[model samples]
Target chain A: MIEVHEIVKKYGENNIVLNIEQLYIPKGQCFGLVGNNGAGKTTLFSLLLDLIQPTTGRIVSNNIQVNLSEEWKPFTSAYIDESFLIGYLTPEEYFYFIGELRGWKQNEVDEFIGGFQDFFNGEILGRKKYIRDLSKGNAKKTGIIAALIGNPQIIILDEPFANLDPTTQFRLKFILRKLLENKETTVLISSHDLQHIVEVSERIVVLDRGCIVKDIQKSEETMQELESFFKDKISLT
Target chain B: MIRLLQFEWKAFLRSASYNTHLFIKIILALAALYLVILFFSLGFGLYFILEEQGMKPFDVVNRVLIYYICIDLVIRYFLQKMPVMNIRPFMIVNLKKNTVINFAITKTLFSFFNLVHIFFLIPFSIVLINKGFNLSGVFSWCICILVLIYINNYLNLLANNQDVFLYGLISVVCIGGLSEYFGLLDISRYTSPIFYNMYTGKGSLIVLFLIIVGLHYVVFRFYKKNFFLDGGLSIRTRSVHAGDYSWLNRFGTTGIFLKNDIKLLSRNKRSRSTLLISVLFTLYGLLFFSDGLEVYENPTLHIFAGIFVSGGFLFTFGQFVPSWDSAYYPLLMSQNIQYRDYLNSKWWLIVIATGISTVISSFYIFFGWDAYVAVLTGAIYNIGINAHLVLMGGAFIKTPIDLSKNKNIFGDKQAFNIKTLLLSLPKLVLPIVLFAIGQNIFNSTTGYLMVAGTGILGFTLKQRVFKQIEKIYQKEKYKTLKAYKAQNNF
Candidate 1:
């Protein structure tokens, strides 16, 4: 679970990027955040990870104030961007590195990656290619897989579907569904793909210019409603 | 052409680190002035020194010219950055390829290497003229040397990849030295005549002029053929090597960190150069010890050489602590790792590097036990004190290094910053001062023992030092992350 209290991230005077008064991501929830360009989704995620300090407030991950203590790091994992992957490391090396940090043996790390053979599509492992040399899609897959190494209580992924191919995107959805079966793991995924998000997340939150506009549970009409909301924004502008 | 020049001017001026660039340029100007004065003095005294030794000054200059040329090339290879233009922008714009190429070539002529030779050449030529040599012949000889310097400028284009040129130069020197030793060939006998001819007639000047022009054509054609981005300008990617360093896992998390550092140094171009330079530093004692065995009598210079011999890695690669991970710093910061562990791992890394360096420096034993002990004491001092200081200094360094960029000794902006310059003072000065205090009060053996004792004290209290360093790192974490993010724009 994660809590955001009066989180306001400002670049300079008069530019308030993220100003969320309160946000509570409950345990075992499949949370999906959707936003347009410059919607401050990444900024909010960065604040939660404590990569950047909030101008006015703080973020608490699993009851630990992320800014005050490093305790939350053991239970939380994130794959925000290519920055998550070491450029010089092979995918297996990267996985083993993350695993070692989370107290997993090399063979145990091997077993965890083995489960994602279908997800990796044989392009990542045994290729002997550094993450830098991989195509964007493959690199994204590597980061995402590495995040799942130690089975952290909470996993945060930003724009996980952007660079992925359609097939891999579908596989990622399946992977999310499988992750949610545990009923204890909280997966936070942000995406531009409304359909993929709608199919995967039990609850979806629409972010518009740093404000949470809609928070709805998945239903038969959810996809149509979300699509029409985005459609109206294009016409309103 | 004017527009292209304007673009370059604006790009240089508008860079994020323009102030850093300006400061470095001022420093470089001062250094150039110092070098000019130094070379002038050397030139003024060259004739007198040679006369004191009862040798012909002109013959000596001609004979040693080949060595000077080789040394110049080696220096230029490390220091000169190949003139670059963002040709990709011009490729789609309304610009001719020839014009762009010509601009790039012309820019090379303005390099400091081309101008630096004039400082020594002009003063030495004046000395030659004062010695009652023919004016026209001296003029022709100076012109020939200038032409050869230009030829070297163009010849350097083919030697752009540093490793190839460095290895080639070393081998050439070794082979030449061996042949000369065995009396198979006298390179000076052959090379001396070439420069002597320049002083005797104008024909060699014309010949040297033709050679420079030919070199220019070759370089121009080479650049022309590989002008496209995919052909020449594309980033060179080496074959991926995934070496298993799990053997290092015995030390636990520290081992993992060290393995990653190893991979980083071996795989990345910039870091690889740092590693190479560190390995070479172990032999730094050669500069002093090669002069004479009497160097052992001077504890001050011996201590200085010893510090460099083992502390090369600590000074060179150790200063850039978290910046080496600047590319993925956020990931490390957010990972399930303690700040103490991270700093401890870096300390261990420095210790291991110093240990390896000390072992390599054992070859100094052939010089004497005193030289070996001096190096050993320096290594202990580095591992104990300098390692902590360098890491602590690294906490304040927020600049990000582009690890993929090929190393240019003088081209890197981060290589010479005010913070690093200030930090280097204590790292280099403290040990010598400590040893000097003991030497003045007691004797040479007492100096070594006292310095070694101080290092042991620091080493024993390293845990306390790490606590303070970790606090600094924690305080500066967000600022460092912000700086890296701003520069990388990701």
Candidate 2:
């Protein structure tokens, strides 16, 4: 579980990236955050991850203040961008490295990755090239897979479906859904694709500029309503 | 902690020599090890060498302990890198900031630069022990010196954190100057006797140890609060074009390329810091030309210092050539720009830099016009000959330098090595050898003419050299791009 309390991030005199008064992402929920370009989605994620200190408030992950202590690091996994990937290693080397960090055995990691071969599509592991040399999709897959290692209690993926092929995207959804079904893992994913977000996320939050405009539980009409909301924004633009 | 370091060690090794042929790494490692051992041996044999040179080893070293420690601190401050273990993955983990930072600090304590001073002290102490000096006191002195060195390491981190360490550096220089002046004047001979008494005094190391612990505490507090991966990675300001390089617009394709090159150097912290450091190094000529004018009697030393002073900007910037743009190299490669034009743009930047340095160093005319001509010849040769050699050397370098990391002067282990420094050695040394032979054997004018003639001939053959290096670049293009794409170095 993650709590953002009175979080306000400012860049100078007036520019505020996020001003969420309070947010609690419950355990076992596949929470999808949807937003436009300047919707402060990444900013909120940054605050939650404790990459940057919140200007006005605090974030508590799993009952520990994110800034006050690093106790939450053990249960959480996040991959926001390319910086998360160590580009020099072979994909296999990278996987083994993550395994070493989280105290997973080499064989366990191999077995786990072996299960994702279809998702990898024969393009990631066992490849001769370094992860940096992988195609953008493959690189994203490598990062995503690395984050999932250790069977972390909380998983956070930012723009995970972006830079992925359509097939890998579907496979990733399947993987995410399985995680959701576990009912013990807290999954947080942010994406621009409403349909994909709807397909995987049990609870969805919509953000505009730094405020949460909507927070709705999934229903049959949720996808149609989310689509029309964006379509209306487009017409207004 | 060991597990964390183990990962770092693996990254260090696996990341190195990815683009280089295996045989070269072996040879280069052997060569660097050989040189390190050779320096250690020189340290071991310092007493003998000083005796041969008619200097009293104990008298000199004892008297100049302050000078040695002070100068070493300044030099270490400039060149020594802060040991950084990228702690990003550990941040959200159960790992404590204390554990991570202490590992980084401890690792730095064992850095080659820190340990090098011991190489000298150990030998000197052995000589003192052999000479029947108080062994425990000598041992304590050595421990204190080593502690002081570690303190310097922590102090360097603190100073580097503050941006400019000029105050510390200036105070060191002023103290040394006053000490030397008074030490010579016999106006209450101060620093030498104080240091000598401190070293010979009993249990001085306990105090030294206390100072080190206090420093460690300060350094701990500093890194604990400020250590963040985002600070290391994030672009603090958007000034990709903060400076006006628009004057380069007139020079056609190469000019356009040069403008971008200028922007890259001005924008990126790593490259910009190196450029600023190189400019600071222009002051190095003062070290050679100011003192014993007798020092420049050795033509090899004189010309080597001269070239380094006048054309070092080219050397530093050119040696990394294409690697500087490795981050955006793929985009550059995919552009409609011609490879020759891009190469020429780099060449132009080096030439223009060399010219500015040569003119600045022309002030050496006060020392001797021959020295001035030598600086000019060095600049010309760097422009005409070593420029292409550097480009040729760049073509073979596969380690992509992180342009953005303000981490340190040398971004990563692979980005710079003794072998890369030696890449243009023959070109550099050939002029030195020719100038030496011509000056000492023939005449001073022949020395200047010999260097100048070589520059002229090389400038004439510039087209041939460019053609050769271009072929080399073509062969290396694909592999270079592959290596550049990887964040192999953390």
Best by DockQ: 1
Query: What is the lDDT of every predicted structure here?
Result: 0.85, 0.74
Q: Encode model 2's per-residue lDDT on A86-203: one tens digit a residue.
A: 5444677667656654667669999999999899998887656666567788999998988898888888899999999899999999999987786999999999999899999989
As a TM-score, model 2 comes out at: 0.60
Q: Tens digits of per-residue lDDT for model 2 on B216-308? A: 998888777767755542223341223455566578667666656665676455777778667765767766666566766565666676777
lDDT of 1 by residue, B1-490 (tens): 8887898899878787676656777876788899888877877888889989999999999988887887778777767777643666677677777898888888889887888788788888999999999998888998888888888888787777657777788667767767876989889889999999999978898888888888888888888888887777766566786676868888887998989888988988778778877988887798777665674556777778888999988877888888889899989988898988888788888898999999988899988898899899898888878898899889877778778765454335655778778888877788888889889998888888877887889999988988898999999999999888876772
Q: How big is the positional error of residue A45 in model 2, measured in Å on the Cα after superposition?
A: 30
Pairs of residues at least 3 apart in sequence or in different chains that clash in candidate 2: A73-B92, A73-B93
Q: Residue B443 CA error for candidate 1 (Å)?
A: 1.3
Please state the CAPRI-style docking class of candidate 1.
medium
The per-prediction tally of clashing pairs is 0, 2
Which regions in candidate 2 have their CA more than 4 angstroms from the true location?
A1-237, B17-59, B78-84, B166-190, B200-204, B227-241, B276-306, B406-426, B429-451, B457-475, B488-490
Report residue B446 deviation for candidate 1 (angstroms). Answer: 1.6
